[model samples]
Target chain A: MGSFVQWLIESMFLWKALIIIVIFAITLAIAAYSTWGERKVAAYIQDRRGPNRAGWGGLLQPLADAGKMFFKEDFIPAQADKWLFILGPCLSMFTALMSSAVVPFGSSFIIGGKEVFVQAIEINIGILYVFGVVSLGVYGVMIGGWASNNKFSLLGAIRAASQNISYELAMGMSIIAILMMSGTLSVREIVLQQHGGNWNIFYQPLGFLIFTICAFAECNRTPFDLPECETELVGGYHTEYSSMKLGFYLFAEYINMFASSAVTACLFFGGYNYPGMDFVERQLISGFGANAGHNVATLIGIGSMFTKILFGIFFFMWVRWTVPRFRYDQLMNLGWKGLIPLAVGNLIITAVAILSGYKLVGIWVGLALMVILISIVWSLRPKKKNAIMGA
Target chain B: MQNILNLPPIWYTFAILSVLTLFGALGTIMSKNPVHSVIYLIVTFFSISAHYILLNAQFLAAVNIIVYAGAIMVLFLFVIMFLNMKEEADEMKNNKLVTAAIVTALLLGGILIIFLRRAGKEKVDALGFNSQTGMVEILGQSLYGEYLLPFELISVLFLVAMAGAVMLAKREQGERHF
Candidate 1:
């Protein structure tokens, strides 16, 4: 076993290819299952038994959905851009799955006497890669809508594009605060930084709040989901899409949502680090020695990371259920008139604090100033004192 | 070549990342609608960030993504979406111009290839670089020490953008109050 593993690594082509294929498969599989889970979640939320007919508590629902979609008649509206119509869902799904490539699921462990990192690809700029992929995420919507040749679909896509672009300000600025404190953007480094209860939540609570809110906006989830408001947009950008193509769009969204949630957890909340994570690592390491046997330890790390991500996803779902969708104007105002300025202020405070010797004071003073300013602005709004002449 | 292969798989991931970026740029142009073009532009900026990561310039990559893809492109997309112009091909009647556009694009590609060919390539040697190098510390040191003026300038630029956005979005100055 040891010899064969060494041989595989040395071969380079074979092992890396195998690794790539495995990661690809796992990512798609996870995405597919999440679709099923989402349906079950929606059903349960709506007080209905969901898809229990398909393979024991609806375990096979995704499969059934896939089958139906594939065999369903695919149609393209005559007025649509045929090529772009085809490209839309493909682009969306591709970008969504590509993001998983850089996420570090676990630390390196010895397998068959060869040390290997658990992540599919350990790009130092993993965080950036995720960002880039996510930015491209909007393309799927844009193309699909444009190709649909429908005014409503196009309007929906336009709204989505604008909303994402707006909220991304707060999102980017907030991450900068984390980047300043953690001093690293690499997810692995971010995770390792939490060796002994150094989770970012303790240090940068405000930034975490900003990121979580923006993540919802970015995912088009909940109150921020004006782009796809069923009452207004009638299925929005995916309105003209049908068959597997439509499934692809929805599937891409859930996967992207899950992945984004994972990223949020990994960055601000300590990716896989838990309360007693170190103790578990120590005991496992002492028992197996990093080289002798360490799969269990790595698995533990992966599980912990997933737990954090699951919590983040649940948070997303909870918000989706709880919050009412915002008006379009309100959404835009939050992004531009609200979050952008706050993010900019946060960036300045973070930069100043990190540079100067007064980190704690910088944060507190910044937050206080912002609050006071907001309150002042709110109160100063010209309230119409109406003693209407109608009497 | 042997030594290069010995580098991690991520070493070649750069090639893939770069290709995705190029695709983004191409996608932008192929998209007739300016809104779609802008979305692709955002993707292009992001892919550039990915390139920064591959080069181990992690800090720059993050900042790049945040500034270009996040802030700048958002503003651009907003403006484009507001305008809502139908896909107008001023060149739609001119079949001759399509060939011109294609030829010019190809020429640009050829020039880039020539530039690449002119540069002598070297083998990978790790050279004191690693995953840890692209973190907050080095980024801060570089930004404050060397890139300080530019950093300050970004604030000015942002202020400019704010003024510009307000002016653009505002109703004509001698008009009715809201």
Candidate 2:
């Protein structure tokens, strides 16, 4: 029995299980707080005092919201496909949770003479895994909308499917530049490559912009939240959803926001890689012993990662409140015409830069050329005279 | 009991996945609703991806899920939903068509079995397998270095297909836009 206990303690799988649980809990906590944060941000932006009555500046508001959601009536439409209706939110929540598995939350720590990574799993094809999971996320919304047997819900689902498919192309193309630069698909390697402020954002600003926009579209956040646009498609895809089912759908969105922010930070903004990380690591090592210092440094990295992710969440909310949602045709035009061509151009520039062994110079020059070309096209374009203004 | 317990975990995983794959395939064909059929097909795709992962082909697994289960299946669901196919009206009522389908299915199954049997005759050293062969780095190296032409050709083919689709979908002058 003692030996079995010892073995369990020493087992890698056991440690991994513990780490997974911790990460899952942390993800849920963050997602819950993000709802509160969104409300606060929205209120502040609109010049209102948001939910301060709840524990300490609305800290416990998410809990109250969850409780209320739980107590609400769980209504399934008479015509709704019951199983698929339930499966919709489950799949959404599942995919949203699964995408975070490969994200390296921080550097590894020395634990029990073993190097324990902060990430849940470190797959070689991390980016593709995330992409696959994200792609699967559409089914949740699609299935829910369809099963609702409502015209407005069907419209919302159709809009979501097309939007996701369109933006995914540009998103994949934009990431190719980063893949070329990093030369690895693993999120850990990508983060490590961007150590000490040598971030991808500096070199691939245009690609980052495209990626960020695609990320917004992918998460179905504002400007791209056409799927749930309250103005037109009343309640949109989740029009028929009620109680905990609706809660699950809403919770999944927050989780997706958190996961995408983490991915963006890791890919471009130098995830967990603060400017003085190396210096701090060195100082800690000198002060404390090696293992302890390394562990502390890992903790600090985790802190930095969370900070960036929170800022990303804040940015999401900021844009949500600030930008007006695009018209359907305008959204399609921006995705297909604007982003795709730009991403392809960026890809070509990246390929050329890498081939010539002058990545920085080549990219900047290419960007300049693109800007000039755009300006020329803008100048040559036909302008319509406004009848009202008599231009 | 000891012998059963001593079997590698992969064997158990393979068994479960094989069962899932078969179940999903059967469900796809048998389900009444087209949307349900699509969902079942997605399940089959996911199981196939798991099989790929079991073979240590992580990249292929990811791509399989991303392409088949993700994009293609979503499109399938979208079309099925848009058509609002809730009835059994589309089901084949002709006995001739049923007989033809059965014959085709049987013939395909027979051919697949023959091929599998022939392939199984070749010796495989599971212990000596090079795990690195399935890694993305090696896959990339071979794709660009050795099979570059075929890769480019495939991409060009896709581009042509995309252009054909666009051309087919394009609105002619004086046509109703909707």
Candidate 3:
């Protein structure tokens, strides 16, 4: 029994399990704080003080909200499909948590003379894994909405399904450009490739733009949040949900926001990779021993990763407050007509650049040509007459 | 008995997944609600994807989930949800159609059993097995290098189908087709 216990303690699986739990807790904590952060950002944007009476600058607001959600009556509609209605939120939360498994939060730490990766699992098909999980996220909204037996909920669910499907095309296309350049799908390899300020965003700016827009649509954030537009669909898919079930749906959104932000940071913003990273590592190694220095550097990388993620989250909130919600037609048009075409164009240009071995210069030249073409088209277009003013 | 007791952990996983796949398939056909059936179908897809993973074909597993369970099943559920299907609608009203279905099922099962029996009798050459063939790099190389023509042709076929769909869905200026 003692030998078995020792083996258990020494096993890599035990450490990996602990790391998974830690990352899971961190994700939930960040998601909780994001709710508070959203309110503060919104309040500041609207020129009002947010919930400051709860704790120091409303630090404890999310906990208070959670408590309120827990204490509230867990209401289920009489006509609702009981099992599916419950499964909806659970599925949503599960998928949201699952997508974060592949994101390399930092570099590896050396413990017991062994390299412990900061990521939960480093699978070769990391990007595809995230996409697969995210695509399943729609079911939560769909099931919840359909099971509610409400017309409004059904509409919201339909909107979500269509929106996710439409945006996912553009998103996949955009990511293809990156994959073509990197020639790998593993998120860690992609991040490592972007070391020392050599980020993919430099080469794939247009792709990044398309990807970020699609990400917004996928997350159902403001400017693309037609699924839950209260003016039209009440609370949308979660209209019939109450108490913790409703809390789960809302918490899932925040978690999705956090996860997507982390992904964006990793994909475009050089996740966990900062300029002078090598220099800092060297300095730390000189100061401390190799293992300790490497561990410290990994911590710094983790800090940099969190900084980028927080900034991405802030950007999400900023856009939410500043941008007006898009009309449903406009949202669909942007996704299908606008972003898809642009993504395809960007992809073609990237392919040409890669083929011709011009790489950086070719991409810039392609961008210039595209800009020139767009300007010429804009100048040559027939002007519309203002029917209302007769101008 | 000794071999069974000392079997590898992967065998246990395979057994569980096989059971799940069968259970999901049964649930899909046996479920009363159309939505429930769709959910069960998704479960079956997931178990199949897991089987692909166990075979070390991670790319196939991911694509299976993304395409079948993620996209296709969502569409299935979407259509089913909007259908307003009554419980009575699930009943087989046509005896002739039911008989045809059963006959076809029996024929397919017989063929599958015959194929399985024949295949099982053949000796396996495990030495030639290359597990690395399923990795992304090797798979990509084979798809693009060896099977490029067929891949491109299939993509072209998909493009044509998409165009046909769009043309069929398009409406004339004055027509109220709906």
Candidate 4:
């Protein structure tokens, strides 16, 4: 026990442990409040006053929500497997939190004469790690739905599993383009490579579009939320769940949205990087001390990263409210036929451009090709049958 | 007692992983429910992936989780759920079948033990833990350079299998479209 404590102290494990707790708590808090945010966003979109009765701007609404969940009776269906019934939500929350371990939130800051990276863990294969954990998110839904012992729940789970499988392919292909361009799998390395004004969105715009659409599908957001569409499945996978277990499933969705948004910001946007920040840091250092300048830069970087994440979340909500849910077949069709081919084409173009040393021109060429392909698909779509309409 | 305390961490990890892997594999066949069996199989895969991580095969560990536990096992569960195989059908257990199962299991175990013993004899000098072994760059180099022909052939084989599956699953013109 003494030796173990000594090793822990020598490795500075306490700092990392503290960071993990902070990140996990912040993630859960954001996920909880996102429900309120969603409701407010929906109300604003519909031109109505939103939740404001709890506290100032309904800031205390999430607390009230949690209180209600805790007070509600925890339930398990009579015929359900009790253990798996409980394991579902736990798995959901676990996988949702696992993906954030490798995400870099800000630039390195000096503390006690040592540089500290603003990530829970700096794994070598950061992008792959995220993909692996996110892919496991399907199990929570599948197990939960199956254990519910309801036909609707089982159907919803099956649909979710297949949807995840379909979309992950395109998402992975889109990321492959960025991987080729960045030439690294580490999220921190990707962000550092995109420092200043060299965000990947500029170079891989088509890939970013494909990735964003796939991200929406993977998160079960609007246009791909057939699994839980209220009109069809009636709460879908969580139809039989009640109390905190139900809360866990819903909270997991918001957490997934948050994590995927952070990942998108890190991959496509400049993660924790702002234009002219280096110059600002240099001037600040010349005027003040080195540590103060670095602290300022790191603070601004963290703020910028959070801003990007919040905006991404808002965009997800906005799209959810605006666009209607897709038909199940249409969702699959879009994933397999539309996004996969586009991602493959984008990847090929990116590779060719890299090979030919015309990287900037390559993006433009990719855009042109996508536009042409869209037009071709649009024109080739079968026209409505006039005779049936007339009859 | 001192040696036990001084033992490296990976040995403990390996012990735990081996136990978990064995339990999962046994549970997979012992479970009555097909869904439970698939879940057990997933557990087995996870323990194996953990073992890979302990061996510093990070790439293999991630791929193992993503492809096997995440994708393939999910599909297995989906099929079982779709077919609504909630409980296993009761069949008469013959003594012959039971004996055959036991003999087959023992034979497999024996083969595994033989391989394990031979592995110790033919063991190459094990390299110390190095970050380079797990990086994508080195893995890619070996895969593309030393194993390129086998890799391409395996991909082609997968392509053929995919085409075969598609051909077998396609509906005929007379069939009702879902």
* Top model number, DockQ: 2
| Candidate 4 interface RMS | 0.7
For each candidate in turn, the TM-score is: 0.78, 0.96, 0.95, 0.94
> Cα deviation in Å at residue A4, candidate 3?
4.7
Worst ten in a row by lDDT for model 4 chain A: A382-391
TM-score of chain A of each: 0.89, 0.96, 0.96, 0.95
Among all windows of 10 consecutive residues in model 4 chain B, the one with the lowest summed lDDT is B85-94
**Alpha-carbon interface RMSD for all candidates, in angstroms:** 2.9, 0.6, 0.6, 0.7
Report the C-alpha lDDT of model 3 over B8-121, residue by residue, as the tens digit: 999999999999999999999998888999999999999999999999999999999999988999999989888868766634878998999999999999999999999999
Q: Candidate 4 residues A1-391, lDDT tens each?
A: 9998988776757778887888898888878888999999999999998999999999899999999998999989999988889999999989988888999999877776777788899977899999999899999999999999998998889999999999999999999999999888899999999998899999988888898898898888888887788899998899999999999998999999999999999998999998898998898788768987887778889999989999999999999999988878778878888899888888888898899898989778867987898899888987777744222
Q: Residue by residue across A336-356, what tens digits does model 1's lDDT show?
A: 777777787777777887787
DockQ of 1: 0.28
| Total colliding residue pairs, candidate 3 | 0
Model 2 regions lying over 4 Å from their true place: A1-7, A382-391, B1-5, B94-107
Q: lDDT per prediction?
A: 0.77, 0.92, 0.92, 0.89
Tens-place lDDT digits, model 2, residues B92-174: 88889899999999999999999999998987787997888888999999999999999999999999999999999999899
Native-to-model Cα distance after best TM-score fit, residue A350 in candidate 3, in Å: 0.5
* Candidate 3 Cα outliers beyond 4 Å, as residue runs: A1-7, A378-391, B1-4, B99-107, B121-123
- Per residue, candidate 1 scores C-alpha lDDT tens digits across B132-154 of 65775676777788899999999
CAPRI grade, predicted model 1: acceptable
| Candidate 2 TM-score to native | 0.96
lDDT of 3 by residue, A1-391 (tens): 9998898878777879989999999999999999999999999999999989899999999999999999999989999999999999999999999999999999998999888899999999999999999899999999999999999999999999999999999999999999999999999999999997889899999999998998898888998888889999999999999999999999998899989999988898889999999999999999998999999999999999999999988999999999999888778878888899889989999999999999999998998898899889878988877643331
- Clashing residue pairs found in predicted model 4: none
For model 1 the interface RMSD, in Å, equals: 2.9
